[model samples]
Target: MNKKTQLGVPLSAQNRLFVPVLGASGGCGRSTTAGLLACFLAAVGSSVVLDTAPRLTSPWPSWPTEHGAGLASVPPGRPLTRHQAHAAASRSDGPAGKWSVLTDHQDWSHGPLDLPTDPAAWYQLAATGAWQAVVADTCHPVAHDIVAARTKGQRGLTAAWCALPFAVPVLCAPTSGTGVAALQTAVKAITAEGLPLQRMVVVLTATGEGRTPPVVKAAATMLESQVSAVLQMPFDPHIRVHGLSDADRLARQTVAVGSALVSAVLASAHHTWGDPLPPAPVPAVLSRTAVDSRSARPAHHEGVFT
Candidate 1:
């Protein structure tokens, strides 16, 4: 560890990737593919931070005044309703540098029991400073109390309170056979509610409208080996301009299948195992030549160690 302190710590900092965009059910588009993959990783500069897991409804851009900064909301059994406070005071007129959308906790629906028992002090205040990337349009299907409040407290500080190491659960089934018995009963209810089956993946969203390839290899053998990888999004037309337009419309949206999923999430951002793999397993319908060959390469992903 010497060489001017190992060349001033480089080697890509041992891999730093944290993209969470699961959705094989509640809208296969996963927040319009995480808002066009966070506008193609901030249009190639990369300083993204689009979090969301507390309870759901906080897509970012709603706090014009109901309570102001610190975005509030405590609605469930009653008491704590403030929710957006004018979207945290318009994130203080964001856009001076960009990348910093961390709404501590406000309730999206009941996800991870509205986690917030100190998520690494809001993930070190949202990975402070020179941000690299952080996209997180998550919520839907995998929600074991927000994966135990994101691995809570000292487990070495639970992925350093949001630095995360593995939480990619995208399984939007429906290729038939009752969507392979509801994706094998949701992988036996997340491996009998224990979690971490080598950090599962399993994707198969809207295959366009042709359903073949043995129905995507019989839903990848129904999560046989507790699923490690599988993705295939066939139906394209720029993914049907995301449910008839909410915003983006670049001639139809498939900016090269969302820029090959933001270049496979910036080539798996350093890779200490935080997010990347889970986008191949289709057949609820698709064909236009397999949606033009899954928008030409960058098909599903796979991982376990490196």
Candidate 2:
């Protein structure tokens, strides 16, 4: 890959980007795509990954963390602060750059968490952190949501996020006959909702090591005309064996695909919002005294505001 290709969008306090990795169905490599996007985007600016999967199914809690509270640590009633949001996330630094991850860390034996279902809530939580880039590993059935929203004449999370000026949604599907069929259905549903199909990027992930399937090839050819870009994410042996604990171990091709995904998202954003994208809305700032008071409390008591 060219050196320029590896370079990511330059982000700063003045602007931020949100990339929501929307999966077509279960086991479609949504989390992996989100993680890779965060890793590459971190190369240019501060990045974070929000795992929106349920507590029991989420893999982020299993990753290493130091003094982190995970998503369960976020307060429900009040607005979140950048300090509090960062405190809740697990930080990691490596060849890919520095990034933080926030997800459910509650034990399986515990009851289900009251996670926010509205897309705006998730976007608000991300914006509170003042991050340069955010990759949300969304778990909702995007096609169903879009179709339901249309039926009810209400904007769903997928549509609402795509409507954002700074957001770029990625649809993930496996490279199989069934997956391709689901992807096509999802594309139609999104189109029906009147969302910008041209701004959406579709990622066809390889499930195993093998030649590209004919079904996937055909689907890609069909999707190229319907969406912004169709990307092929090759299977990585390291991910198959060890999961996404270490991004540095990903295959060269896999890393290149991640870089390309970032580029495509940036291109889409620029195309939609113009060359100089609109400045990011500044998050609320807390008083220095209040911040100090909050920091003085024990880490275990983070979510409980006095």
The candidate that wins on TM-score is 2
**20-41: candidate 2 lDDT, tens digit per residue:** 8998877789988888888888
Tell me the TM-score of each prediction against the true structure: 0.26, 0.87
Off by over 4 Å in 1: 1-19, 22-30, 33-135, 138-168, 171-195, 198-201, 227-239, 244-306
- lDDT agreement with native, every candidate: 0.41, 0.77
TM-score of 1: 0.26
Q: Write the per-residue lDDT of candidate 1 for residues 1-306, one digit (tens) a residue.
A: 332121122223223345566543544556555555555454433334444555345444432112223324312212111132223322211111223344444344434534443433232222322233445655545433334544673232222322354233334464555555655665555555555433444545554566545755766764545555555444566436433123244433355555555554444342424343332222122223434454322212210000
Lowest-sum lDDT 10-residue window in model 1: 297-306
- After superposing candidate 2 on the true structure, give the runs of residues whose Cα lies further than 4 Å from its correct spot: 1-9, 64-67, 283-306
For candidate 2, the 10 contiguous residues with the lowest summed lDDT are 297-306
